[model samples]
Target: MKALKPRRFGWWYVAEWRLRGMRSYRWTILLMTLGNPVLYLAAMGIGLGALVRVDVAGVSYLHFVAPALLVSTTVAEGFNEASWPVMSGFRWQKFYLGMSATPLAPVQLAMGESVAVSLRLWVQSFTFWLIGLAFGAFDGLVSILIVPIAVGAAMATHAVVMAYVATIDNDVVMTFMYRMIMMPMFLFAGTFYPLETMPVFLQWIGWISPMWHGSQLARVVAIGLPEPGWLIACHVGFLAVWTIGGLLWARRTFTKRVVV
Candidate 1:
């Protein structure tokens, strides 16, 4: 085989390798991409949604919740992708060390992992959007924008988590994050209802959560949920900051952990 030069296109090479590794669990991915929407839409959109007759956020419960679900699901997947896989790269599998032996830079490794995670998030978000459409949970064609919105949210969340995970040496922090941070953000970040419904003190959770930012954006596009222009700009800016800042942080941590 010809010797390859990975310096210029190292991130793409790393992304390709990560994608090929995903084949090992392709069935799991397929099941999740398909089954989650069916079950959630059936339960929430049909089961509980029917029970609550009043509209939520100016639309039927199904339409209101569908976008939130899409964003939340992708965000959760972002955590999953960033957590164990990142840890495995450093600790379990030590793949980062192996890759570092080659010409690939540490930053390239981070970018590649991020690219792979983003691609998966896009597919999952798009799948959920299609299923939401079938269930009549969307307003119109413009709702397709929710797909990218969800992906952006997921990437922001994933990048931040990956940055943190790169620094940890064990799973204890991961467990703490899931129980104390992730679960709270999921339940309280305006996923199933409006943030204002909660007490004022608790609303801060949604304000800082990527899920909430993404959900709000998704709702606006998916069902025409009324939001002020300034708030929308804030959401976009917040997620952008998290995504870019997190990627930079991950690059630093990956270099520190893998180059030693």
Candidate 2:
């Protein structure tokens, strides 16, 4: 008799399923990945940049804002990937539960979802970067390096949001996250100006915000913004911890929900 083949989990297959579902909305994705950067860069980076009438941090206003927008777009896209789709899987579609009936474990499903979304984010970030380059918002090839840094920060945010979505029973909390949490961070996280320029009390908001950390890193790479080496290390470390911790929590939560 032939030896029995070991049953293996096929998480990448799950990711492929998710990607196929996303194909139905390819136009929306295309518009967003291509249009958003251009619209924002032209509006804020150029239009608002015109009124400033003074350089920011020794570079054109467009340059200073471009990287920040890149970070913001990446984070926003990351959060979005983890939000409604997650809820649909658990609450509406029950696709995760169905997957659990197979050899696919909950942790595998969680990782598969995360990977699919990360791939989407990668494409979006690439589009955003190319638009920035075309507009001359970035200085040189060195600015290309900021692309991965921004994506890493976005993935950190994505992981945390996924963990949160795993525990939620309704979309209400997700709404609050977008309106209260995401919007505030987007507005106040040193995206438009240096944190020091903000009121001292409000500056702390940026200190803890992932968007701020990512933007700081992007600014460092894109424009050579002066930052202490230690501070840079802290930025990278903070993002890394959040990414790892959040994914672990998500995996555990997903296991509990599906395997129970």
Candidate 3:
């Protein structure tokens, strides 16, 4: 318990300012955040579903695609939070420097920022799920059980972030990060189509993408799909592995930069 509490505090410590603002703003973002999923439902699910004319995982294209959308958006949002926001805190904002002036270690700040960012991503998933509810797009209340799954997506994003920090020097790479990496993952991660239906060579990407794992789990939970117990375990296990592994790498990068 002693070890666990400080780790929890490390993440919480990163988001103190944002949390304070949220408490005061008490800002409800459910509607605003719903915009992307709604557009997704319209453009991809309904738009593309119109032409696909095939069932995936025994559900209509929209129903099958919706839950994955819930998880991917959360994963992407986590990467966004970890990247520019953390960079800004360190570079332009110098907020971490000020926090460093306090007793809060830089490592805690980094972890806290990741966790804070994860919280934002979690909200994105929750809002998307609520929207899924209104449209009758989800199959079961077990859908709510996927919050932790969405958090796993956040960890996956953070992994991308730790790997990203090693390469950063200019603003140009950010464009590459999104265009080359994030975009491809979005399209091919079995979000709109089943992994089995894709070309065999391309299927490898989905196998490695954290977004894909989280997305698949969300779909199973939300729709009450009759997946085998072990398959679900694989999805959840990959995400958990990424989350823990990413935190370790991120700690190393943060310590390397901030401590010495």
Candidate 4:
């Protein structure tokens, strides 16, 4: 194995490489990055929200949905980042293989990828939160809490998916995952509506979803939504477990694939 470089530079190299590749599509990325929050808030919050005309969760429909959307969007971004990019790194471009040849260990590569994804989630979540502020969806300064909550959701999802990707030989399963798994979680995990409104059988989906946990925490932090302290502990605990478990799995898989 090559001698490890300085730890900081090793991590920076991994993250910077990914960012440089992303720079090629900066215009498209910028457009979608800013445009999505505006359009979603306008269409779902204003247009559809007008017809409902009921204060949901003790707040306007827009406000209730805004934090949830921030969490959901970050979850979606995390999944997307983990899906095709992870596949490409292993199979198509074999970039992870190349990185393994250098001073970077498999664990370092994984951590670096995580750092890049986390930074992207931070920017995306903040952009959405800022737009929400302009729309008057956020309550006030406290609503800034959505960014960290959203990033937490992103990290949890990204870590789990990265581990899953490490074990798979092909990406065809990703399509099924997006359609059958992610879509259901997005639709039913307290994003568009509260979980109580959903039937009992469906509530379990949200219970297991990182998006729901993150969204609930966001609502509590953003607008002082009332929730039991134990439930809050559950949310935090579950996300933490997912992140830790997933990283452990990813480290094992990466070591098998790259180091050995």
| lDDT of each residue in 122-229, candidate 4, tens digit only | 998999999999999898888898899899988998999998898788768888899988999999999889999999999999999999999999999987889999
- Per candidate, the number of residue pairs that clash is 0, 0, 0, 0
- In model 2, which regions exceed 4 Å deviation? 1-9
> For model 4, where is the 10-residue window of minimal lDDT?
1-10
Error of 1 at 216 (Å): 0.3
| Cα deviation of 243, candidate 1, in Å | 0.3
For candidate 1, the 10 contiguous residues with the lowest summed lDDT are 1-10
Q: Once superposed on the true structure, which residue ranges of model 3 sit more than 4 Å away at CA?
A: 1-11, 20-32, 159-163
Q: What clash count does candidate 2 reach?
A: 0
Better of 2 and 4 by lDDT: 2
Single out the weakest 10-residue window by summed lDDT for candidate 2. 1-10
lDDT of 1 by residue, 135-197 (tens): 888768899999999999999999999999999998998999999999999999999999999
* Model 1 misplacement above 4 A: 1-5
Query: Best-fitting candidate, measured by lDDT?
Result: 1
TM-score to native of every candidate shown: 0.97, 0.95, 0.86, 0.96
- Name the top TM-score candidate: 1
lDDT comparison, 2 vs 3, better candidate: 2
Rank order by lDDT, top first? Answer: 1, 2, 4, 3
